[model samples]
Target: MGPSLAAPIEFSATDVNGKVHQLSEERGKWVFINIWATWCPPCRKELPELAAFARAHRNDPIRIWGLSVDTEQSPDEIALFAQSFDLSYPIFKVDPTSLRIFGNIPGIPTTFLINPSGEIVARHVGGVTGADLMRMIQRNQSNK
Candidate 1:
């Protein structure tokens, strides 16, 4: 097998509610670290779908995190966006440096699927739906 890429699986970011979310604390569960922005249309379109995914998988060993990478937007604006949608998951406002773990973020709507062991299993660089999220979960759990 080819040498594996070690994505930085540890980082901390606060949610809109002022709760600090650390990837390490979510051990023994699946984690979805989604990097998105307020101005990205695709990202906007996928928010609710992702919220559905979060609710659907709330009881499962998985988590869906929506991190806003909008460097130009205010937290209040992002919070307004969250309120408008009544998002199911916490929306984290991260600085550009905090997202360095993902490496060379070219655009919005990037998602990383992490397994229970804290290993990144999938990295999607665009929008995703509830169906897409479930399939990835099932596929990865089956492998485990």
Candidate 2:
């Protein structure tokens, strides 16, 4: 789903490691933002692929962020979960209200693919494959 954001979605959240990351600071890179939760099955299944997507495209200007929307879990717990899966992307336990920056996220496992220009070009409301991500990012680049 493609919806031109009324304005470039901007957010700043602390990563599990305690480093603050901001969307606006990530200029010139394709920001892959995934809103997930520890208890979400789809999110669990998609984590590895998102990590792989980030690894496979390491040479590209892609920055994948795994934002955990698990209100019940502490950052330490979420970080432990990510560590168990060996997820390589930056992981953060974020507030559910952070979803409003993009739009009304119907549920967990919502992901937004923002292009280098800071425009959200694609979104997936469920589990997504690495191939799907590759194609979409490639197609987005080709269009420009």
Candidate 3:
């Protein structure tokens, strides 16, 4: 967990389907923005966990989005990768070296947990399980 951000982070990226998704638009729900890459083993491993977590919270006030830093792969290839993992959450393609909104990535598989108000409350720097995510959400909720 990290200190609450002073201001809500804002950015928008187009998904594989070409639909633009803005972080600010998800203000009323908890949002998990996962930065990953197709070549990263840990990133590939966490997809199923994230997918399950998304499904489990489908009706809840939570949203999970994946950002793939694979510059070499085409949108169709990326979409296929998501399909291979059964990842139904929105996944976008981004430049790995330039993620200004979330600051320095430091590593792949980094995940940012944004509160309902859009403030970034937690950041995980490695692969995370669905249980780990749920625990973080519960812990943050209890803190409030």
Query: Which candidate wins on TM-score?
Result: 3
Could you estimate the TM-score for every candidate?
0.87, 0.90, 0.92
1-144: candidate 3 lDDT, tens digit per residue: 323376777878899989999988998898999999999999988998999999999999999999999989998899999999989899999876557667757798999888887877888999999999987788788433
lDDT of each residue in 59-112, candidate 2, tens digit only: 888889998988898889999999998888889988786566676678879888
What would you estimate as the lDDT of candidate 1?
Answer: 0.79
Worst 10 residues of 1 by lDDT: 1-10
Off by over 4 Å in 3: 1-4, 142-144
Q: Which residue pairs show backbone clashes in model 1?
A: none
- The residue ranges of model 1 lying beyond 4 angstroms of the native Cα positions read 1-8, 142-144
Candidate 2: residue pairs that collide = none
Per candidate, the number of residue pairs that clash is: 0, 0, 0
Count backbone overlaps in model 1: 0
Instruction: Using lDDT as the measure, name the better of candidate 1 and candidate 2.
Output: 2
Best-to-worst ranking by lDDT: 3, 2, 1
Candidate 2 — number of clashing residue pairs?
A: 0
